[model samples]
Target: SAMFRDYLSRFSLNPKQKFKTLSRGMKMKLGLAAALSHDAKLLLLDEPTSGLDPVMRDEILDILRDYITAENKTVFFSTHITTDLERIADYIVYIFKGRIIYSGLKDELLEKYCIIRGGEDDLLKIDRNILIGCRKHYGGFEAMIDIESIGGLPSGVVTEKVTLDDIMIFMNRKGENSCF
Candidate 1:
């Protein structure tokens, strides 16, 4: 707690005095680092990085990294923001509406799901089974599918790489009236 107070004091007028005044970023960093310092065997965090500025997010993630490196320690977290996962997670588990849609090594998801872009006609030519999800573009469709199944797509379309964020968007899309 003293370390936190020390860090918190940096932004305050009274350097030696303690007060309940700290910037959002500073509070987030201090809280996360302190939590890790408590020596918890398992940490369950939900969107811990949400709304933090990029630099502070990175700093907190570094602390998380150090904690996870300790013997018998584990970190389980959930976030819609994918960039953080790319930086910190060894594996990815995708969930939607409380259902576990996918769970595997991070590398495997990156290797498997890819974006295939093509006109409506060309998209019709691809194998249906290969398409996990899709988003409609202005004049074409961008599909998510297994990379090896690129051969199954029509020749006219271009297969571009995608991020976990793209896959999440497709997975989370609900048809009309699904929302209340």
Candidate 2:
């Protein structure tokens, strides 16, 4: 009861408000309060920041950071909002079509994948097995590749750091290698 009250106050939720009257953000806070009241070592949240304003989203992320630090707990958070993960996650699990594409430390995932852009001719020279995804356009092509899988790119190709959003898009797109 006290913990719930504390969380309610911390989130600035009105104690007298009925659940039906609560905003989406307030409902999320209420869920967090309930989960934290237990002795569980792990917390699972699904799109907790969905529909929340940026400020409220930041607040929820801050709360998560504090929870992990104070309790030495693990949070299994699932969301399409990559920005939130970029803000607070130390590890990341990326899934597409019910299959996990990547799961590891956030930094390693960021380092391991890259966006490769080149003319269609140069891109077509790459082995399809090494490509996470690829798209061919009128003038050129861009693909996602594991940095380790790259031997050496053709002269006109360039590689850039991959973001979480890029990973999602590439994984979801139709590609020559559909088995990722």
Q: Pick the candidate with the highest TM-score.
A: 2
**For every candidate, C-alpha RMSD to the true structure in Å:** 4.6, 3.0
Candidate 1 pairs with clashing backbones = none
Tens digits of per-residue lDDT, candidate 2, 88-156, equal 899998877888877889999888889988887786677777788787777788889988977777878
- For each candidate in turn, the TM-score is 0.77, 0.83
Instruction: Judging by lDDT against the true structure, name the best candidate.
Output: 2
Q: At residue 130, what lDDT does model 2 achieve?
A: 77
Q: Once superposed on the true structure, which residue ranges of model 2 sit more than 4 Å away at CA?
A: 177-180
Off by over 4 Å in 1: 1-19, 70-72, 174-180
lDDT of 1 by residue, 1-180 (tens): 675555345423244434367667666655665665566798899888898888878877877776688555889998877998988898898888889877999878887768777887886677666676766767778777777777755789887777888778756653321111
Q: Flag clash pairs in model 2.
A: none
Q: Which ten residues in a row have the lowest lDDT in candidate 1?
A: 171-180
